[model samples]
Target chain A: MLLPYLLLGAILFVLGLIGFVTRRNLIIMFLCTEMMFQGIILNLVAFGRYPLKGAPTFDGQVFALFLIAVAAAEAALALALVVLLYRYQGTLDANAYRMLKDE
Target chain B: MPPHPISLSALLPELILLVAGCAVLLLGVATTAHRRRLAPWVTLLALVTAVVVVLFEVLITGRATRPPAAGSGLFYGSLATFVRIAALELGVLLVLVNWSAGREEERGEFLALLLFALTGLLLVAPADNLWLLFLAVELVSIPTYVLVVLSRSNAAALEAGTKYFYLGALSAAVFAYGLSFLYGVSGTASLAATTRAVVLALRDPNSLQGGLAMVGIVLSLGGLLFKIAAVPLHFYVADVYQGASSPVAGLLGFVPKLAGLIAIFKIIALTGFWDTENRAVYWLLWLLAVASMTVGNVLALRQTNIKRLLAYSGVAHAGYMLVGVLAGPLAGKALATDGVSILGNGPAAVLFYIVIYGLANLGAFAVLGLLRTRGGPCETLRDVAGLLRREPGLALLLALAMFTLMGLPPTPGFWGKFALFGSALTASRLTGDTWLIVLVIIAVLNSALAAAYYLRVIAAVLLYENDQPAYAAPREAQSIGALLCGFLILIFTFYPSGLMRAGQHATRELSEPRATAARTESPVASAVDPPFASP
Candidate 1:
């Protein structure tokens, strides 16, 4: 059962990494990255169920909680920037925003 | 469990900082919204008090009959002191430098974030548990992400902030997932225990999970390397630096990088990667370090924008610092005792290198911040032409910064690279590892390569004619900043004995006793100006 869940997460993560690298839509790339993070969190909580029996077992769960919090904060800030990007350039395509291109 | 760890007495300064952060938050809410300059002032006061308290603790502890061990307290020992002092110093500097940046409304949030970030850096080195490490990393990062967006006026600020957050979060997630795998194998987050478990797990052929876990740990470190703007993960740095406002860029460049470096050091120390027979981790660091050094330096050569150039330059230096991590405990021995073993002096050299790098880098940025134009700010290298004619003193400071970056003599950057290169050469000789020698060669060559661009800025400022329109000149405050940073650069070079002594002392206490005693009695340890060992 654990193996199957782990395999599923690996699939999702790879998919997210691929989309993030391949997709040119700035918003979609962000979504894919978020998906990658989510997959990691899923893997963590699943493995955390059987933490060291008597040694404060909630470490993984606590870590997961923190991850979610950071994810929320990141999303809030990223979305705000997205709004600003569209306002500045009138588009959200990664290819279109070449102001900071490698020189 | 386990006697509730240890007494929280060792955590006095951190506790004070925590209180200060809360007080600043409350004050921000209570006071008039526009008059938020008070927040930074309050944060500054709190940091001062915290620094004082830490000094008191250090004095008290040092005098004690039995000093606390490495793993004592919630977090105790000299390594804790080194980490805390570096973080706190940078934190104070960030607040001082960024004091006038952004609008009045944003200052409060900005200071609050900086204070919170410092708190995170303070927690990282002493973090015995994996949970603490993760928490500390996040605490440092979250506020920094907010700081990237604080400059409301710049379109680049908003874009940079967004990209930074997205990538930073993605990396943090990667770190967490890998951490979970390690926890599963060890059934504990204590770094020592985790290392033991990793060793046991790695030995078994059937433990594919354990092998995967090792990969996860390495992968997670990629996120941290990103924060430090090290190679491969260095993609975000130039853009972020270019996009963010000057003060914000300065903060991003220094404070977070320190935090990330400390985290990297702590994790490596806990894992005892130095003792392990597997050369895999060392090889990985070597490859990354070389890439970071070569790529960052080569790329920086063509940059027209000063900040973008510095950004790449900073990445290359991070690679050099990682060399110390690869060199490990004997470098500590070299610090605690020098030249006893050819293979081990790299760590002490690295520690000293970081101090010099931090001071020089911050001083450089502070000067750059002062050079604003009517077009808003002068980030491009062309803007600096003929600056020496108009402002000779300021131009000199820029030259000093460039010289330091190039690791030329008398500057801290040179001494920094010299110490590490010395150790790298010796280690390579003893171990017969040609790769280590190659790294040293690359490092030296890169320093020479860096001189081209670094000198170009100076040459343009001093020799080239100014064609760009000169608008309203920098005010009194800007010049003051320039003068202060310039003085610091000069002072670090001129009176190197005290700081070098302090750095040597700090490195001495960082490792085990056998290494310390062996190192303490060496000639190189005592000799201040010995050139690297003969080929």
Candidate 2:
């Protein structure tokens, strides 16, 4: 019964990882990371709801809440950085920011 | 479990820094003059105060010998005290390196962010709570992302910040995901509690669930690899370091790397360690140590940019430190036949080495920040070439850093490497683990290979003479920081027994608790039905 939540969370996580790796746009890549965070949140909450053996506890739920707060903070910072990067390079393409690397 | 994992007094120093970080922001609001004079002072005052408090706790109060209220998320021991003191002391140097960097108008935020990052780094040692550890790692990271951009106004800094943020976010997601699996398998977020769970998983390695349980560890470690700039995830180091201003690059060299390694050890050391039965865990680290050393050295050889070279050097150094970690802490005095006890002290060696590496790295970067070439700041090999003619003092200081990094016999860096390789060799002999011996040979050979690149820096400064080495307006504060690192390394080289003894003492209790726990070999069996009973 709990297998579906685990599989769903796992699928979302892999999808997000794939998106993060393949996408070139900065905003979309960050969104992909957020997608990854959601997968974690889902997994934690589901595991909390139906634990492996013991009675359900709030540990995973509490962690998920903190995860939400941290994700929000990351989003706020990510948006600010995106705006700043957008100004200088005038593009959101990850390829545009290649000036720092080696030839 | 009823007793709070974190006590008020336990976190008093970090609390002080946090309040001071916020106060710096408020002081920024007061007036420009107030901030210019007061921000750094406030930051330094808090750091100094934290150092004093930790020393007081360890020396007078005997926090070191106190048995950890086991199952408490924080370990109250000499290790926490020492890591706190190191982070705080290094923090003061960080302030010195960053004293006049970036825009004066935004200096308040810069200093405040440094405090926040250090506070996060400070918390990593005692934070055995999975949630707290994750956030602490993120806290160190998020501030650093902003700090990179703040350190310089150039497009390159922006690009570095952009790459660092994206990759950092991805790493965090990967880490959290790894942790979520761990929490699922263990059914708890407390690291101490997860120890029994991890032990059970290790005992049943043939089961499929055993593989799943171990994935949590390997995946989280993979995520942490980014922070330490180890292979597979170390792609960002050179770009970020090269793009950041020199002082900030120096800051990058030490803080996150130390925190990541400590957090990884905190997990391993707390979990009764990746013991002999776990060949996969051993080999994984073995592979990382081999790969990081080889890759970091090879890529660094051809780098013309000074900062990029240091970045690769940082990667290679991280590889060296991994040798100590893979060796694990010396289990007991029973392992001793003589003074060779030093060989088994992996945790202590890493703790000692990273700080020494930080000092030398800071001195190198401080000297680099002091001088600039015609095109820009000291960016290339030729920029520092012939520095002996223009400035003998700075050139000599730079050469000292190079030699130490090269692990020349007479330096503190040599002692650090000696401790690491010795630990691996001792571990191999004790466990009959020939792989540790193989690791030692690889590390030794890599150390020799590393010398070629480090020597290039020494040769550049002392040998070739650039006719027009552009000098930045004298950055006296930064020069003092460089000189301070050099003097400290010199003093330690002459008198390392004190530092070595301290490293050994700090990890003494760190190994003892886990050692007894592992000896019991009945963690899961002792517990009542329902497996993990959340009291």
* Per-residue lDDT of candidate 2, residues A2-94 (tens digit): 679888998889999999889998888888888899989999988777777566667788789999998898899889988988888689988
DockQ of all candidate complexes: 0.34, 0.54
- Steric collisions counted per model: 7, 1
Q: Name the best candidate (by DockQ).
A: 2
In model 1, what is the error at residue A24, expressed in angstroms?
4.0
Native-structure RMSD, model 1: 8.5
- The best candidate in terms of TM-score: 2
Report per-prediction Cα RMSD to one decimal: 8.5, 3.3
Candidate 2 global lDDT: 0.81
Give model 1's TM-score for chain A to 2 decimal places: 0.86
Pairs with steric clashes in candidate 1:
B330-B344, B331-B344, B336-B519, B336-B520, B337-B519, B337-B520, B338-B519
Docking class of 2: medium
* Candidate 1 lDDT tens digits, B1-535: 1223345666767877888887777776666755454777788888888887777766865631123323221344456677677667656666666766666656666777778888888887666567778778888887887787785466777777777886787777667766777776665555656666667665652667557656656866776888788888888888888887766776776677777877776556544565553576678889989999888988888899988988899889998888776766554453334523323556666666776776667666766676765556777777777777766777777788788878889887776787678777766665677888888888888888888888888788778888662232455544555566667668777876555555555544445522322222221111233122311
The TM-scores that each candidate's chain B achieves against the reference are 0.88, 0.93
